[model samples]
Each structure stands twice: as C-alpha cells, then as structure tokens.
Target: MTTIARVETFLVAPRWLFVRVETDDGIVGWGEATCEGRSETVRTAVEQLSELLIGRDALRIEDHWQVLTKASFYRGGPILASAVSGLDQALWDIAGKRYGAPVHQLLGGPVRDRIRVYGWVGGDEPDEVRDQIAGRVEAGLTAVKMNASGRMSPLASVAELDAVVRRVAAAREVLGEHRDVAVDFHGRFTLANARRVAPLLEPYRPLFLEEPVVPENSHLIGELVRATTTPVSTGERLYSRQEFLPVLQAGIAVAQPDLAHAGGITEVRKIAALAEVYDVQLAPHCPLGPIALAACLQVGFATPNYLIQEQSIGIHYNLGAEVLDYCVDQQPLSFVDGYVQRLTAPGLGIEIDEQAVRAADKRGHAWRSPTFRHPDGAYAEW
Candidate 1:
C-alpha cells in the first residue's frame, strides 16, 4: 500500500503557489494553489493542511478532501479552498499515475477529443487592442478575451462608455464573424455602469461580458442579464459551489471557476455538475501556470457542459516568468488551431521541471494585484 509521505509547497514567480505531494512508493504529483496576490497566505494554509495528510493513504483522495475542508470549524474561503485545491490536484495526479492513466480518464473518461481555448489580449489599461487581437488571429487562435475598460467610474462618463465600445468594436472587426472575442469587465464596473455598457456592446456581438460587476453584487447579475442581449459570464472570485449557485441561478450563461481557487479537481467537478443542471456551460478560469492549466484541462476534457477555456499564455500579468517556463515538455500545453488536443500522458499529463521550479522559488516574488483609486482618492476595483 502506498501511503502519503510528504507534502510541500513552492512559491513560484509571477504570482503562483505550487503544491507537491509524494507517496511512500515514490510517486509524485503536482498541483497549483495560486490565489494571485495571496500566494504567501495560501502557502501557509497549505503547510497547515499538510499535517492531515502526511501519513494517510494516498489513494483516499475524497476522504482527504473532506478532512482538509471540514476538519477546521472555520471553513470555505479563498485561502483554505486554494490550499485544498492544490493538494486535491496533487492527490488526483498521484491516483492517475498509480492507475497508469490520465486524470481525465479517472474522472469518467473524456467527453470530447479536444477543448477550444481563448487567449488574453490587452492589459488592464487597454491600448493597442486591435494589434493584440490581430496577433492572436495570426497565431491561429479562434477566440480572444480582452478587458472592456480599466478604472471605470461608478457612473461612467460618455467618454468612458465610448472607450469600452471602441475596444470591443476593434476586437470584433479584427476577429470578424469567424473568430470570437470575450470582453472581461474584471469586476471593475458598477451595476449601473455595467447595465449601461452592456447594451452599447450588443452591436459588436461579444462572446460574453465577464464579471460585469464584482461577485458581491451577484444579486444584481440577473438584472444585468435581463438588460443585455449579450451572454453574461462570471465566477473567478467565487470559490465554491454554494457561492456559484446564486450566480448560476441568476442566469449567468457561463461559469468561470478557477481550478486553483475553486477547490481543485474534486470540488470543481462538482461545480461543473451543478452548473450543468442549470444549463450553464463550464469555462474554467485559468490565468496562472502550467500545473493549474493542466488541472483545468483535465476537468475540461471530462466535463460535458464544457465551453471554452481561458489560458494565460501571453497574459499581461506574467512578468519575468511564463506558463511554459517550468514545464519539461510544452507540447501538452501548446495550442493547435485554437484547441489543445486531449492529453494522453499519465497524471496531470505534463511534466514540471523541478529544477526550474526550485531555482525560481529561491528568488520568490511578492506579486500584489495593482491597487486602483478614483480621481478623488476613493478605492476602485483593480
């Protein structure tokens, strides 16, 4: 019997926390537990949770999840969920490696041969929107997602509203009808602002309007959905199925749970199942590293309600380090005609370069999400 021997966490560059689990039989599995700006907090949580798994059965993934999430009375938040997510992924990886199959195969086999993916274009304060969209088009990508606006006002001025439309219009013009473009509000708009902007974007026909308002204002999401012809998508900040239920019930067309933040493979699969019941499609939100992306793809392959994937191959946030930097073979992550073919390798299906990871951890970073404020010094969503 293979019992768990060690659990470790690494703080990788450009804001990612990776968890490594090794069994007594020497089988190893990797998972990403990144919470973006809160990597250090999540790292500590990972260490605390590791105490529960050190001498347990490696194959008891579900039982471990129950303890890691429920053992503590104070439960369910980004930090704890992120920690469990990473460990959960590593355990599933170990299970797949032990069974000599991919994680998706263990999740009840593949429902699709390949999954379509989208790339990020434009930064927080978007400029050169057309050029970036053109680059993605030239790269043979079929879909692209860009910010709708940056540092928007509570009640947007005419100029602010016009700028949002212009960015989406440029993207639609470049993408044409053959390709798709998704506009992410990045939780930067007020409900009123989102309501006003959503109608203006209808002529351009965006694939979806993401996070039109912050997760806290989710109750208003149904109103926004009712006001717009465009599909409404959200859930990057939401960490569990309970948080997602109201948004799903509120009429979100897509559910964008981050695999690293949403309780890893174990919880996210349940979230996907829950979303399926509401007729909403699953598009796991992933803007971190290879391990997280690999985990997201594993779930995507087996999820029947899967829509498209959001990848950070060239996203603006990746500074000094990129997704493929720690990967031993980049082929599993490489995009071909806008879709990644089903991963056939064992475990999470990609080999992480341990040496590279170790070296990066030595020069660990403190990446904080940029703070934004209004002209009068009031706090603004980043």
Candidate 2:
C-alpha cells in the first residue's frame, strides 16, 4: 500500500497556484488550486489542508475529500473548495497512475473520443475583435468566447448596448455560421441590462451568454432565461453542488463550473450528473493553466452532457508566462480542428516541468484581478 509522503504548493507566474502530491512509493501527481486574484489566500488554505493529508493513504481520495471539506467547523467557499479542488485532482491523478489508466477511465471511461474547446478573444474595439477572432479561426478553432463589454454601467445607455451588439456581430461575422462564438457578460451587467441585451444577441446566434448575471443574482436567472431565446450559461463563481442546484432549477442551458474553483474533478463530476438531470450541458469554465484545463478535459471526456470547453492558451491575463511554459510536453494540450483528442496519458495526462515550476516559485508573484468602478465612484463588478 502506498502511503502519502509530501504535499507541496507552488505559486507560479500569471496567477496560478499548483498543488503537488507524492506518495511514499514515488509517484507524483499535480493539480491547480488557482482562485484567480485570491491565489495567496488559497495557497495558505492548501498548506493548512496538507496537514490532514501528509500521513494518510494516497489512494483514499474520497475519504480525504470528505474530511478536507467537512472536518472543519466552517466549510464550503471558494478558498476551501479551491484548495480541496487541487488536492482532489492530485489524488485522482495518483489513483489513475497507481492503476495504470487515465483519469477519465477511472471516472467510468470516455463517453466521447475528443472534447470540443474554445479559445478566449479579447479587444472591445470592433477591429480588434474581428482580427482576434479571425486569428482563432485561422488556428483551426471552431469556437471562441469574448466579453460583452468592459466595466458596463448598471443601466447601459443606447450606445453601450449597441457596442455590445456590434462586438458580437463582429465575432459572428469573422466566425461565419460554420464556427461558433460565446459572449461572456462577466457579471458586469444588471439583470435588466442582461435581459435587454440577451434578446438583441439572438440574431447573431451566439453559442451562449455566459454569467449573464452574477452568481448572487442566480434567483433572478430564470427571469433572464425566460426573456431570451439565446441559451443562458453561468456558474464559474459558484463552488458547491448545493449552490448549483438553484441555478439548475432556474433553467440555465449550460453550466460553466471552473475546475479550480468548483471542488476539482470529484465534485464537478457530481455537478455534471446533477446538471444532466435538468437537461443542461456541462461546459467547465477553465481560464487558468494547463493542469486545470487537463482536469476539465478529463471530466469533459467522461461526461455525456458536456457541451464545449474554455481554454486559456493565449488569454490576455497570461502576461508573464503562458499555459504551455510549465508543461514538459504540449501534445496532450494540442488543439486539432478546435478539439483536443482524448488524453491517453495516465493521471492528469500532461507532464509538468517541475524545474520550471520551482524556478517560477522562486520568483513568485502577487497577482490580483483588476478592480472596476463606475464613473460616479460606485463599486463595479470586475
């Protein structure tokens, strides 16, 4: 029997926290616990949680998840859930390596041969939007996701509303009817604004409107859902299965739980199952590094209700280092015709460049999400 040996956390460039777990027998597994701007806080949480895992059996993934999540008196939020998410991923990786199979195989085998993926396209400017999306298409990607607007007002003016429509129009024009484009509101709009904008986007036929409203306004999602013919997708801010229940009942067409923030593969698989009951599709929200994307792909390959994936290979946030920088091999994450073929490698499927991770940690960063404020000095959701 392989006993747990060491658990370590590394803060790498471009705002990502990676968890590394090794067993006494020498097998190592990696996971990403990135909680965006809160990387430092989540890193501390991973250290505290490591105390519960240091001497236990590495194969006891579920038991560890239960204790790591429930043993504490106060539980279940992005920090704790993100910490558990990374560790849980490492454990599943270990289990897969231990059994000589891929994580998807352990999760009841693959339901699809390959997973469809989408890349992020920036530039609120019309020309930038068109050029960026054209580049994605030139790369052979079939789908792309772009933000609706930047720091939008609660009640958008006609010009602001028209700009949002124009951006989507630009993306759709570049993508053509053959390819797809997803619009992300990023919780920057009020419910009324979302309701107003959702209908206008219908003609462009966006794949979906993401985070149409913030997670806190989930109860109001149904109203927006009812108002729009376009599919409403959300859930990146939501962490647990219970939190997802209300949104699922609210009639969202797609669920976009982030693997790093949504309790990793273990909880997300359950979330996929729950979403399936509501006839909703799983499109794991992954705008982080390779490990997080790998974990999302593992669940996507095994999940029947999955729609598409969001990858951050060239996202704007990746300034200091790119996703493939820490990876030893990039083939596992290579995109062919807009989809990543099934990852056949064991564990999380991609090999991490440990030396690169260590070197990056030595120069660790204190990354924070950009704060937004309305012109009148009111706090705005970024």
Candidate 3:
C-alpha cells in the first residue's frame, strides 16, 4: 500500500502552480493546477486541500477526489476544481509510478503514436499574424492558433472586421494548403458582432473557431456551429461535466477542456469520455505552464478522440519563464513535424527541476489579465 507521506505545493515561474505528492516509499508524482490569471489563489487552495490528502493512501486517487470535491460543503469553481485537478494529476502519476507503467496505460492505453499540437500567435495585425505562424512553422509546428478579433463591441468598425479577416487571410496564405490555422474568438466579441465576423474568416478556412460567444450563450453555440463549415471548439470556461452537457448537446464538434480548470485528471478524463459519446473531438486547452502541459499530455495519450493540443511553449504571456525551464527532461515535449511523441515515462513523464522551481517561486507572480474598457466606459473582456 502506498501511503501518502506528504503533499507539497509550489507556486512557480512564468505562471504556474504545481502540487507534488510524496509517498511513503519516496516515490513522487507531480500535477499542475494553475489558473492562468490566478496561480497564487490556486496555490493557496492546494495548500488547504493538502490537509485532506496527506497520510492517506496515495493510490486511492478517486476516493480522495470525491472527498476533496464533495465532502466540502462549498464546491465547483475554478479555484477548488483546479486545486483538485492538480492533486488528481499527481496521484495518477503516483499510481503509474507504483505500477511501473505510464499514466496512459492506467487510463486504458495509447490511442495514437503521437499527439498533434498548436502554438499561439498573439496580436491583431496581419503582419504579426504572418510572423507568428511563420515562427511556429519554423519551430516545426503543423498547426497555429491566434486571437480572431480584438476588443470588439456590440458593433465593430469596418477596420476591425477587416483586421480580423486580414489576419486570418495572412495566416492561411503563409500556411498554404498543408498546415492548419485555428482562430480563437476568446469570447471577446458580442454575439451579434461574432455572428458578423464568423463568415468573414470562413473563406480562409480556419481549422476551427473557438468560443465565438461566451459559454453562457452556448445555445447560440449551436447557431454558430450550424452557420459555419469550420468546427466550433470551446469549454475552457466550463467548470464541470454538467456545464459541458449542453455544449456537447449543442453539437459542438470540438471540446476544449483546460486540464487546470476542468477538474484535473479525474474530471477531465470523465469529460473526455463524455465528449467521446457525443462524437466530439477532445483538444485539452493548456496555455499555462509545464505541469499543466504534462497533465494534459497524460490525458491526451489515453483519449481516443483527442484532436490537436494547445500549448504555451512560446506563447506571448510566457515573458518570464518558458515551458522547459522547470523540467529535467524537456525532450518528452519536444516536437517533430508538429507532433509530440507519446509520453510513455512513468507518472507525468517529465521531471521538474525542484531547485529551479524554488528559485523562481521567490519571484512569485501577481498576475491579472489586462483591463480593457469599452468605448462607453463599461468593462471589456481582456
């Protein structure tokens, strides 16, 4: 029996919160639970959740997850779900380590030899979009994703519409007919404006259009799904399985659950299974740090319906620390021709550089998405 000896949490660089679980036999497993704009809060939440885990049998991940999620009177939010998510990932890592197998093996088995991935290219201009796609291609990425529209309102200007179309067009031209380019709406546009802009980018044949409208407007998701030939992908904002039911029922072709926010391995795996039944493709959203990426990879390896993964290796927000900065073995995440070979190592596969994590922890971040104001002084989504 593997008794949990200690549960430790680290708030580390760029923007990530990691939870490490130590077993009595000295085997350790890692999980990532950082929310993009709230790493500190989630780190604090993991500390509080640690009380429920320490000294328990490390192999009983599902049992611990039940208590962590249900035993507490309060439940279901980014902070708590993310806390559980990280712990669950670490526990799975521990299980795989204990059994001398990869985490994917425990989930069932590998569905593909490798997983395809997409990189981010920020900014709203055609030139920036062009340069970003070229960088990703140069880096050997087969797919790239960028923000579709910027700071839009109820009615966007002709220039804003043109800017969005031009950016998509530029990426398509550079990518030519071989690679795929995904456009993320980022829930930044009003429904009416989103409807107007959707068709404009459609001609360029985006790989997919993500979150054209907010998740709350998911009923309208079906509307957009029916409106375009491009696949509609969403779910990072969705917190639980119930939240995903409607979106899946909305007939969304792609499901984008963020491993950090969507209840870790325990919940996201269940979510992936649920999506599988709907005949929808799974593409876990991960723009945080390495632990999150490792967690995403573990699930991606076992998920049969997985599509391309979104990673933040060279994303714009990674101004301070890059993905491989905290890992001992960065080669597992290394890509060739746009695909990451299956992560077959025990637990989460890659090893964390503890010393590096501790040193970067000292500079801990206090990050908040930039504030944007609408033309009318109202708050705008950032």
Assess candidate 3 and give its TM-score to the true structure.
0.97
lDDT of 2 by residue, 118-211 (tens): 9999998989999999888888799999999999998999999999999999888888889999999999999989989999999999899999
TM-score of 1: 0.98
lDDT winner: 2
Model 3 lDDT per residue over 207-228, tens place: 8889988877887888887777
Q: Which pairs of residues collide in model 2?
A: none
Worst 10 residues of 3 by lDDT: 7-16
List TM-score per model, in order.
0.98, 0.99, 0.97
Evaluate model 2: give its TM-score: 0.99
Model 1: which ten-residue window has the lowest total lDDT? 122-131
Can you give the lDDT of residue 316 in candidate 2?
76
Clashes of 2: 0
Model 3 residue 221 CA deviation (Å) reads 1.7
Best by TM-score: 2
List clashing residue pairs in candidate 3.
85-264
lDDT of 1 at 28: 96
